[model samples]
Target: MSDRSATAVVLGGSVAGMLTARALASVGVRVTLVERDALPEGPEPRKGLPQARHVHQLWSGGAQAMEELLPGVTTRLREAGAHRLPITTDMVGLSPRGWYRRWTESHFMLLCSRDLLDATIRAQVLADPRIELVERAEVLGLDGTGSAVTGVLLRAHDDTRRTLRAELVVDATGRGSRTPHWLAELGLPGPEVREVDSGVAYASRIYRAPEAARDGFPVVNIQPAPRTGGPGRGGVLLPIEDGRWLVTLFGTRGGEPAATTADFDSYAREQLRHPILADLIGQAEPLTEVAFTRTTANRRHLYERMSAWPENFVVLGDALAAFNPIYGHGMSVAAQAAVALRESVEEFGWGTPGLARRLQKAVARPARAAWDLAIGMDVFYPGATEKGPTRAERLVAAYVDRLTYTATGNGRVARAVTDVMSLERGAGVLLTPSMLLAAAVGPLKPALGGPPLTGDELKRAGLQ
Candidate 1:
């Protein structure tokens, strides 16, 4: 109740945390971002964020949001050697039924090392005069009740914990967030939780792209065929900054990829739906040792859906839900959710009662979209979860399969899919009467016989 303006504490230094700080900081709120680890000085490796070892993308939809939150960030990334890859046009992927031909470009993506992404956003967020970062500061819990959270307690570098009073606290600590436990401590029950894990394991390594493909290589992806009655296996070659290609090979329970050098190339050649990745990488130089994780899962904490929730607190990003990273929607969803946070705060006054609840609920709209898109195929892959898809899941999967098949030949259908995936539009837009009619009418063009690589592209890739 001091005369000074209210303060906010953001827990965790993940992408979500930085973006949350951006939203609040932009609104002139004083923010203290608490991180337990020493952030890297540049776009380099950090021990705490192991997921940085995988393929990461900022989809056009998410890129737009990030741009709005931190102006000129895209330019900064590109100047730092990050490639802005146009979708469909710059990507070659093997869909479930067949190879997906490159359609007319509808969206673009930002490809770079996750380290670069984190560093770039961290710099912009911290640049805000209203925000401050406290390294090696770990959050303990909250100070107020179930209806309204007041502040957060911090454990400094010396392990001495002190209360930092605030009018608000945002939980962006990502998948490992203790928000649920914190809520329980305030006498509020933990929210409903749901998890569907396909027992997916990820293995990623950096490759020095060939001189020809260094600056302009297409993003090559061989997506898993979930309907093939076995564990899903997939691979991607992402062109990142500094002449590097971040290649990741992953598989579900019965068909997992390995982390060791002994097993990496074999899985690259034998397991994936296509041999193109292995063929391409055969001549490339390996830059980093393979890194592995079995932590890919769809976990959701339904905090907003709770009948009673606290004010002055909202959980965004991976704290609210963490989708399977293979989908590459995590960063986009985080960006869009951050947009919702900005919108909600503006719609309602910053300190208004129920502002947190409204923002939390709004953020879930994007989370639900990401979750549905992820679990749609994941639930069908063998050993992806404890059980198979529900009856409703099967129906939805059938429809999506038809749509994917249609999209291979129909540009409009492809655009509709991109519209939703880009986070520019909702999935409901796809279910409109016109889209349903288009789906029923079938594709206007024939399915492509092979990938859409041109003669020049082939020559450039050294395939000629």
Candidate 2:
């Protein structure tokens, strides 16, 4: 713990902000979490977070960090009706190459409604006496020069404006963050930014699972083959809490999912690379109308590359880097970033010189990994980037394509791929000499004829 009684302010009350508050409170810092919306009292939706209606999963890598941060968050989530799904084993996924075989479990994911996940974390973090929650508050700008951020200017629910001083200020305000504008006001150079938008739109709906399949149904996914030369389309059927399946279908540009309810089923069956999601969902009962969004883009602010970063200020989560949600890396990356924040504060001590700059660089490690993973595939789609993928991206994509094909039939190769996908290991793990040799050798087993759904699963879904 630090020797001084420092104060910090975190903007945004989402997962990233809550986790940051928890981290700071644990180290004896008094944290004030400011939110633009009045948070829900339970697992209810908030007005600010429209994306909660879609499917989400916390991969094992992020789950581990959450556990480390909150100690029993995984248990809390499971107790609140979340499912622990073993990767590969309990996931029926169709990769760009072919159907991925259900190899033994090397990693796992936590599946639940985003509302439930956020509510659980919120309750746990707000319980800390050192943290304060300021609801219906909007941030106007930073309150300092380019050399150091002293605090924030905020307005409460009544539109009363005031300045709140702090030893540190963190931005967790998601993709709409005005950090760039705020920094400009402070006379600091704006960070370099990159965006890769696939022009993808998502349509999601909730359905009551078939009676027999509610208890142990596996997640089913059909991914698009971007190299096929047409608009890429895909769908995922995630079994979430309350015996309901959260199904989301997404497509790029000309092939986007329809916003109408009647068209949801047809799009899943016809637009996806496979009919597995359609077949399974057809047996279930629709519980909600389709919720659609077109914010599937990969954007990153290269803060670490900035020549001059303000002290006592840092940005995390979607405010720093937002990825295409289909890859399910956003939440995981945020949790990992929180861990990085904690480690940096512990190593450098609060208010230390250049501590904010050091922390920004530390969190970027996990963000960079997820950013590359998302863009590697998304950049292949039409209109994804202003200029098509660069030469380096093309080369990396080619190598990754080979690895994916090899993973379809080779158990070892599959595990290696998941190691990175799970965010458990860095991308360097896939480029090792041994991994290169395995990819060169190709898959060891024969290709699966179709989705490897077991007879039991087929029967449960009434498809046998």
| lDDT scores in order | 0.86, 0.92
* Per-residue alpha-carbon lDDT of candidate 2 for residues 1-464, written as tens digits (9 for 90 to 100): 65778999999999999998998888889999999999999999988788899989999999998888898889999998999999899989899898999999999999999999999999999999999999999999999999999999999889899999999999999999999999999998888999999889999999999999997899899998887667999999899988999999999877999999878888987778888888888899998889999987899999989999999999999999999999999999999999999998999987789899999999999999999999999998999888888999989999999999999999998999999999999899999999999989998888888998999999999899
- Estimated TM-score for each candidate: 0.97, 0.99
Best by TM-score: 2
Please list the residue runs of candidate 2 whose C-alpha ends up more than 4 Å from where it truly belongs after superposition.
none
Worst 10 residues of 1 by lDDT: 1-10
Off by over 4 Å in 1: 1-4
Clashes of 2: 0
Clashing pairs in 2: none
| Per-model C-alpha RMSD | 1.7, 0.9
In angstroms, the error of model 2 at 460 is 0.8
lDDT of 1 at 330: 94
Predicted structure 2: lDDT: 0.92
